[model samples]
Target chain A: MKAVEVKHLYFRYSREWILEDVSLELEDKEFLAIIGPNGGGKTTFLRILLGFLKPTKGEVKIYNKPPNKASYLIGYVPQYTTFSTDIPIVVEDIVLQGRLRKGKFFYTKEDKKIAYEKMEILGILHLKDKKIKNLSGGERQKVLIARALSVEPKILIMDEPTSAIDIKGQNEILNLIESLELTRIVVSHDVKILFRKVDKIAYINKRAIIHEAPQLNIPKDRHFCEVELIDFLKGEECGI
Target chain B: MWDLINTSIYAGILLSIAIGIIGSLIVVNKATSITGSIAHGSFGGIGIGLYLGVSVIVSTLFFTILLAIVLGVVSLYFQDRKDSLIGVIWALGMSVGIIFLNLTSGYQADALSYLFGNILLVGDSDLKFMAITDLVLIFSIVFLYNRFLAMSYDIEFLRLRGINVSLLYFYFLILTSITIVMSVRAIGIILILALFTIPPLIAEKFTKKFYQTIILSSIIAFIFIASGILISYYYDLSPTPIIVLIASFGLFLSMLKRS
Candidate 1:
């Protein structure tokens, strides 16, 4: 069974259509990069897969179950813009929230150990005691990644993981995400950063088209630019 | 003097405990405006209690909780219009209270006491009610600390974790409403927001964690409450205004030091 399966998904916000006839499937442990322009329904597609929204038409299945039922197995790193740094929360406490269970008032020793283990894996264990607001953008991203991983999810999804950081921070985040041993799905606007790392690229406008990276015949030494890549994808859609 | 001192002390302890726990949630969740509305809107309940010959505290508790839930539901359904909705509720509540107070038989000599608290008027029953409120606030905070913290930071993330975010938020507002109403007897409806916000602001400066902020803010609240009571006793003034002034001064000093 595929790790994720979507067939003829359509989403509309009131009178306008946001996503139409979008469909894709992912194998176990595959890395899929979703690239699109701003407001091209990239984030909306991820939200649908995360069960934050339901498709207007068609169905989505994760590991043979609906997205909502399989949500526990899916680790999600929402866009950093959604986080509020004004709250007085430490790194450990924020990460420990991922382990929250119904009727559990206190964080058990096992829960703490798991949180620390995830932080250690993400190389952020040293920053566990630090305030979330005091961390740099890159450090905060890593902490968020550690928090997501603390759930022990089989699939990991990140929305715009590198959008708010500097170039070096972006590269570092992408490299870190590439090294993780889970089925990874990321939505990004920059295609160049993902070109060499992702197994497949799904170019999404209002629709989505999946292209296996190895079959594209793009030279490894060639530097890909965002404008060119966007045009290239648009041309592909036009079959020119 | 001895009776007055005892009353102030009891009121101080209860106020400090509620402000410490619920105050942190208020500041973190940024619910001060909604809390302010609840505090002011509670006057309507007091007016109803007076008109119906019911206990003011009990009636106010019911009224405040109902108002808080209404605000919560409105904000949940209409996110952008919450501020305007709160404004309408804020005005309507005070207006309703005035209408009810005017309709009640005879003149209420102590009606102004509810608007600006008169700690000297606090009887033994009021103290008992305040004590019970403090217990409920403390128990709820202790039992649901993790969930509360999670909800405050990110309600969406908490919901995605399979936690019932709406139910948690409703209970949070209920606790906040209780805190606001209970404090009204000591600090008055007009000045209670100072106590709810100032200590948490100062505590946020001193502590690195949410729980630490709660503990530190409670201690700060105690100091202000105690000092306010003593100052009012020495000068023969209203304790609510004095307490709010002290808290405001502390906040000013903290800001000066930060710059």
Candidate 2:
């Protein structure tokens, strides 16, 4: 089933048409990488998909429902995450926030247990009691991911989750997202490292061009005029 | 001399202690000028209080909440226009308050006290107000504490968790407004933000966590208030500015130490 559907979407900011008549049909549990040059509406389109902004025109449907009410099925992590470094809060409290929307049932022991379980999955369970400010940059991102997972979302949308982190941390987070068996839309600038983790690549430059079908062009260097995208793990479709 | 201290003194001491604790929170939240704006912007509410012969505390709360909602809406509407928009609202609210004071027939005494503050004039009723404000401040801080950190730290993540970022932002603004209104009588409208902000900033220099910063800042603020009051009582100086000056001096000292 299609997890996301966008039709005839249009958005403009300050005389620039960030997104124009863009449409997308995303499969469930698919790893989708959105790649584009700077100022290419990558962020704009991601935010639109996340329903943070109202479209200038047309429709965006997540799981065939309105995006505002469909938040339960989706999770979002933005690029800029550093804030109030001196707030003196532990990692567990930070992760618990992801479950805040479950009405009254969000605070159940099961929910808490599952949130803690995610900390173990993200390899930050040891840092659970540590204050967020005390954690390193990579560790903080791990906590953020653990927090995002506490919602039990089927769709994860990350806007440049690894932009500021080191390469190793980036690869680790990408692997973690891929292993979740959840649909993900990852927005990033680096294209080389993504060849294995992301099955489908959406090259967005004022618009989107998919490099999925059988094969994709791989450029030797990013500075080259032409970019590359190749099918990853298509031959070994792990039954995840 | 020691026998002069009892429930009122203890309550006064508690009052200062609570102010120091909550005051530190107020400052660390970076809502200082915003707190002052709420204090001064609430003059309109004070006018309403004096004109209708209601309690200034209640009136100030009403005005503070009203301005808070207005400030939240304005902040959202003019999200890009930072201080200028808030300044306009702040200026307008105080000027209208002055006009209202002028229109009132014989409420000048109440007007001056409310406009400037009369901490020395605090009696049983004032202490009672302080006690309640402190309770509310502490309770709200404890309850909304997690939300504050989440919104402050990773707003987008919180939003994805289905937390309405706008609602949290407005809720914080209302919290700040109430704190401002609460401090108005003790610290005066003009200097209330100093009590709310300065000590907390100085506290932030020494503390690492949100709670510690608030606690320490409030302690420092209370010390300033008490010492200033003590000095004014002994040496015949104005208490309000002295309190503010001490807090400011603490801030300078904190900065100098950091430097």
| Best-performing candidate as measured by TM-score | 1
lDDT of 2 by residue, B1-259 (tens): 3332233244346456565565654554555556666778888888877777788778878888988888778766676875776787788779878887887787387576665564565666666766776787677677766666666666666676676778877877876676667666666687676666677667767765667766776677667767776766566666677777877887887888741
lDDT over C-alpha atoms for residue B174 of model 2: 75
| Candidate 1 chain A: worst-modelled 10 consecutive residues by lDDT | A231-240
- When superposed on Cα atoms, how far off is each prediction in RMSD? 1.8, 4.8
* TM-scores of chain A in all candidate models: 0.94, 0.85
Model 2 alpha-carbon drift over 4 Å, by segment: A13-16, A81-86, A102-112, A129-131, A217-240, B1-29, B51-54, B105-110, B205-209, B212-214, B253-259
- TM-score of each model, in listed order: 0.96, 0.85
Best by DockQ: 1
iRMSD values, candidates in order: 1.1, 3.6
Looking at model 1, the pairs that clash are none
User: Chain A TM-score for model 1, please?
Assistant: 0.94
In candidate 1, stretches whose alpha carbon ends up further than 4 angstroms from where it belongs are A236-240
Give the per-prediction TM-score of chain B: 0.96, 0.88
lDDT of 2 by residue, A70-101 (tens): 88887777664546666556788877877776
